[model samples]
Target: MGRWVLVAVAPAELVLIALLAAGVEVPAGVRATLGLLMIAVLLVEAGRWSRGYRRGRRRGLGRRAAATVAAAELVPPPVTTALRWEARVWTGLVRGLGRRPDIPPGAAAFTHHRAMRAVRWTFVGVLVVEVAAVHLLVPAGALRVTLLLVGLYSLVWVVGYVLGAGPVRPHLVTADRVVLRCGLTTRIEVPLAALADARPVRRSRDRTASRQLAGRTLHLVDNGGTSLDLDLRSAVTVPLPRGRSAEVDALRVWVDDAQAMARQVRAAAGIGPGAPAELPPGR
Candidate 1:
């Protein structure tokens, strides 16, 4: 906890130092934005604390979600394991029947873990609330119809986002390439030769890379998605799981094991520590 506190404070401290050195006052807009964000967080927490939150417009959806989660917990571990087995079988059946484009079936096994479930469910939950708001708040007739249409678009967006960028879906890593399966539409791969390195990061490194890359990085820091950053051989355009393709200099992905993954990838790609680029501890 102490280390985490230091990590959290480091960035703010750096900003303050830089501003002081430069003899510049903080911008009014920046201060206002920060203040507003703090207030928003406080209000959200207050709402969460109140019993009224449970009885809000999203109450029905909340109850259903809670029930489902509770029922899952009530099942014995062995029973849950058996159910997961069934789920895998069904998943395989669906994959076979759906006839989507996929990577070659070879030495590359399905090492991809399911993306964070909490984040996915939260996205769905927010969309449900938006849909409810559209129906209740918007006046009926053309405007309501239009707003409901907007709500439908939001549904599609949430589904696509959950399927693509948000969740850590199945990924395939082999001696030849790394295949990332993003929902139904995207199957992104980088040749082994193109992968410079793979490094696992905790909060500190995650923040470091995010700061270095800025807009280039794709991750869910607060909500907790995987943050295994991969440096590519060159800048390339890759499709985002949820939206349009963007040319990125590097890629950040979630993997189950960072050390083993980095080792295998380096061995496969024939990269060595002799290279000028310094990789953090695992690399």
Candidate 2:
């Protein structure tokens, strides 16, 4: 009930706010009614969320875990995902600035190759120029200000991507799992026990989807290509954007040193050099 109310009211509130931001004059009574409706809806939702949190606690969940579960249950999945992604972007910006990769203890970090460097920098440069043009050419108004703000926000995301996909967030081979990441957007963690085989394979550059699913294979491409592939014993759930997931029996990713990554994963999974490889069916 609360979720439905929020879904219905949130968009109306946003539209109203946007109109006000764009200097549209709204009638006082209509604005007051919408404001009161939003407040009432929020209060009801807060009560429900509180109850959910308490229920989780009563079931012995930790505070953070309970809070997370409550939020997951109460909030719409798309909103939750967007909030999570935004948090990751800002966090990545900070970590990238510090030049720190999120490698856990006893994990081996393998950086992705700088295959997208030229493309990333070119895109950022274009965004900077666009922002400058907006500031200089557009008349001083709310719409111009909105465009400028959006442009600057986009620039921040590009910087975050450049740093996050570089040294700050590398492919990780840990004792128990293989953590594959594409900047702040996608992550896939496969347990070492589930790893069937690892190998270096070249993918064509014409295939431009950063994350693609074909049959039972999930491709995590970089610069339009992938350099390493991992075959799993069975299909595992791979999370996607907008609260979606895919069950994939294989994963293809790009890394700086494909050979090293394959070797490390093989070694960690206790697969001998002569072990039979059970490759997934062709894509």
Candidate 1 lDDT (Cα, 0 to 1): 0.55
Off by over 4 Å in 2: 7-25, 62-64, 183-185, 232-237, 240-249, 270-283
Clashing pairs in 1: 115-168
Point out where model 1 deviates above 4 Å. 1-103, 107-116, 166-170, 179-190, 193-253, 263-283
User: 1-283 in candidate 1: lDDT tens per residue?
Assistant: 3223333444555665555555668877775665565555545444443433344425554765655544444344555655654554444434434533234556343333343566567878888898998899887765576678779876765554444332324566776887755443345677886777776664333352211233654442322445566777765567652246676656765555655666666667787855534433433
Per-residue C-alpha lDDT of model 2 across residues 224-259, encoded as one tens digit per residue: 789998988867899775568989988988987899
In terms of lDDT, the best-performing candidate is: 2
Taken over the whole model, the C-alpha lDDT of each candidate is 0.55, 0.84
Give TM-scores for every candidate, taking all chains together and pairing residue i with residue i: 0.40, 0.81
Clashes within 3 Å, all models in order: 1, 1
